[model samples]
Target: MNTFPIIETERLILREATCKDADDMYSYLSDKEVVKHMGLEPYQTSTDVLEEINWYQSIRKEGTGIRWGITLKGKDVVIGSCGFLNMQPRHYRTEIGFELSKLYWGKGIAKEALNAVMSYGYKHFELERIEALIEPLNSASQRLVEKQGFTKEGILRHYEYTCGKFDDLYMYSMLKAEFELG
Candidate 1:
């Protein structure tokens, strides 16, 4: 099993998601406003959040991906989740993704958590490229990645099926060299 290390920021902690975090995760995951642009529909119950949490744990154990629960430094509640997805060790690349509660939206919490995770990806995984796929309508997410120095590559038509339809997405990427330069 791979170890998931605790990552700390000035105001946040990125750590493993646990079953105990179900309620917190559900608070956001079940909110229509929060999951509007997400690939999955809003969860209907805390059990759904628990199942999602289990899935997150499974991927980490399988070494396929890593998801961290994002919490305020002094709080025990998780406000969001962020981490690498679809990690390809052979290609030295991975995709980054994050979702935060609407309550925390605009507070710079997501950026802080993602910065810590991205730094880990670059340093530990030695990733050549870190990519993000954002639904075209998710302006907040677009701005977040742009602020992190990810360059917009282009549109991927009908990129994913979600919420009963295919969604187009904008691809953003930051190469290892660019990350180092920035």
Candidate 2:
């Protein structure tokens, strides 16, 4: 993870996120609909976006995880982001998370970007499992993972505490063997 990987797909580019992405990132993260199930409150200021960007930087330096800012091909504006976090290298596993602007909903951009990221994780990191913890009420996320060949392994009760409360999450996972079969 010394050099962040820039993944290019047919219609999108997943590049290292930078401070310059703060504005575009804020536009979506500040939206209530975008943050509702993300276990986060809508960011109210640029400072919040800075903290988010800093975390992205720290993860890369720490070799813990990496998130690429999602941009449309030929465009620099970051519409959303998708990547791994809570990575456990010793265990050969990590958690996947993503968010998109409401404006990009249903466009299949997420699927394309995730395909690239997940493939990188498996091939480069030699990951055995990539998992997602989706808020129970988020059907769209559940469907996205399902479409990607992830298996639903049932609910994890009170799995995380965020935004001032405990939340249950649906655990979905895709193993290297399963992804190879994809």
Q: Encode model 1's per-residue lDDT on 22-95: one tens digit a residue.
A: 99899999998888887888999998898889878877877778999999988989999999889899999999
- Residue 178 of model 2: what lDDT? 98
Q: Write down the RMSD of all candidates, one decimal each.
A: 1.0, 1.0
lDDT string for model 2 (1-182, tens) is: 36678999999989988888888899999999998999999999866898899988898778888889999999999999999998999999999999999999999998998889999999999999999999988999998999999999989999889999999999899999999999
> Distance (Å) between predicted and true CA of 10, model 1?
0.6
Q: Count the backbone clashes (under 3 Å) in each candidate.
A: 0, 0
lDDT comparing candidate 1 with the true structure: 0.90
What are the TM-scores, per candidate, against the unseen true structure? 0.97, 0.97
The TM-score, computed over Cα atoms with residue i paired to residue i, of candidate 2 is 0.97
Cα displacement (angstroms), candidate 2, residue 93, comes to 0.7
Question: Which portions of model 1 miss their true places by more than 4 Å?
Answer: none
